[model samples]
Target: METDFQTVEQAKSNIQALLKGIVGTRTVAIRDALDQVLAADVLSPIHVPAHDNSAMDGYAFNGAAINPAGMTQLALVGTAYAGRKYEGTVKSGECIRIMTGAVMPEGCDTVVVQENVTVQGDQIHFAPGAVKAGDNRRLKGEDLTQGKPALRAGRILRPADLGLLASLGIPEIQVMRKLRVAFFSTGDELRSLGQVLDEGCVYDSNRYTLYGMLTRLRFVDLIDMGVVHDSPESLEAAMNNAADQADVIITSGGVSVGEADFTKDVMQKLGSVNFWKIAMRPGRPMAFGHITNPNTGNAAFLFGLPGNPVAVMVTFYAFVRDALFKLAGANPTAVPLVKAQLASNVRKRPGRTEFQRVRLERQGSTTVAHLTGAQGSGILRSMSESDGIMVLAHDLGDLQAGSEVEVLPFEGLI
Candidate 1:
């Protein structure tokens, strides 16, 4: 059914409400869990350090030995290297030479960094202010306590998370099964990469761009269904096939109210789909809903993005990206936005929100965003040349130079 034009926030909320988590899980080696959503809470099996240890190459001794008014000297008994233990206890007025990560000897509650002390034969001397109690000592269970939850479910595992798991001797982890996504470009004028371009036809760049974006997510099994023509038979067949195999089906073009486009018809015939005109620049026309195969009773979530190159990217990042994350059983993650001064004047209307392509640079102490030439939807180079997107809000009008605006960087997503 046709829905009236809605604001970006409203559209996003609607899409989010319709999403359902995909079920299934699998166990994979920790090395293979990067970018995969964690399926279960991982409780640490043992203390991270297991025992009190030295954080530096130094001497371990009781802090009480330090005299507040003068230098304190302590006799060095023995040495303790990493993986090696000093069996004997440290007595008063005595210290043990300890390497980094070495177990702290009994009766020692502090460490004097090697550089802070002067060695004189069997004695180590340091000023009263050279070290403090409990300094340079890594206490047991400081990093992660035994039987505590180290990592929670629904987190997208990153490099640091893998290191945490490895520190606890965890060899494998439970992760949600990757979401399957089938996508294709629509329009008879769309041509494949190797095919010769006709008079009016252009190469289908949407498919390639979509492929790149999906690949970076790393949690999706991508199926490039090639280019589906603008016909009921072709569109319906493609949608059904995609629905049968994938958890989400994405298509570019054929969504707008064009006389020749049959994408809307095929979508309605298959299942419930809502056509929406979001109040946003670059991408406005969009279709969202679920497509169910009548014969097989299989279904998949749908996202019909705009045909323009930049619009496809903008819409995907603004809407589809988060939806896909939710559908994949990932925890909600907020994309960071930083304020930057505009290097030049920008013309913006008040009603619809705008995503202007901008290249950021350091202007003295303040970061500034310069417009990437023309802001045309068909100009894909604008996106390539830009470092981030400057979000001009719906209530904001034309902005002058040096005005502060929020910019969403392309750091993690690119």
Candidate 2:
């Protein structure tokens, strides 16, 4: 099959088209639910502040043209602490003592900050020319109006979102469930963890890398479907077992056109398969498909990542991870990428996309990114020690120092 590898923008569009509203909808609690995309529009059931209040500890007075600078004597009403509102009206030349978050009295229009006013036995002294109208008042529903959209669909809730929801007294929210994912590795040269390595057997680093990456995504279930050797029957059995329970299956290695590889043949027999060699160095031979579990008649998407540590990581981040978000009912939203100054030079191939691991450091109030030395595909240490991928354009072969480049934080879209 002729597989014209999709460009980044084209790939994003394709993923969007394939996964529009794929998660459907579900509900969850607000506690510890940050980054879970909102499934529905959040309508403000009530006003945000619920009432007009003081934003700072201050003195509330009418200030109805009574010069506060020259005013010497004023009656001191009872103090209004936070969560307590003084219900009485403020007459001329009279002020109410109000604390931060306290509701402002009905007749008061201006607030004199506590620093600008002095209290002496039922009398308050205001500094010269200090009366400011609406200085410290938090207007009712200033943040949001009744029936207003507090939050929109497809938004990944953050700390502020949680705080706003809590302020609205919404203890729970509707969110799509996490993506259920299953992954495995196939190779005769691979060995599981804690097992003594025999000659020619390398520890399967791809499995752990995929596991960690999936863990960072906070998926509903990151199931390890176990190791499958270079056998068609074993590969088929693993696929059938995983597809029955998992929404998506992720396999590392063995998608290339090799005689020992059984992933492609099994994918064809079980379900439709689409294989492609991405135009990216260290991650070129990545593949994607769908698989049908024979026993349960359930089908799920399958991803075959390259064997190299760097290739698998980059491909997982770009391709497989996006697919998992779609399966989890997320908005298929693109993760944010920021531009930062480059501290050192970076060189790459002109035709292939490169994701260089970099460490962003603060140097004299400016953040600069420097490439980690080892660029080999087998180096897992680089990915662990660095911040995130510094994506280089396909046509650009070299990035000079002091040039601004995209910096993807490790914490993004987690």
> By TM-score, who's the top model here?
1
Check candidate 1 and list the clashing pairs: none
Residues 9-43, candidate 2: write the lDDT tens digits: 45545654654334556677898678887888999
Where model 2 places Cα greater than 4 Å from the true spot, the runs are 1-5, 20-27, 66-74, 259-261, 332-334
The lDDT, on a scale of 0 to 1, for candidate 1 is: 0.92
State the lDDT of candidate 1 residue by residue for 329-391, as single tens digits.
999887889789999899998888899999999978999999999999999999999998899
- lDDT (C-alpha, whole model) for all candidates: 0.92, 0.78
Error of 1 at 363 (Å): 2.3
Cα-based TM-score, every candidate: 0.97, 0.89
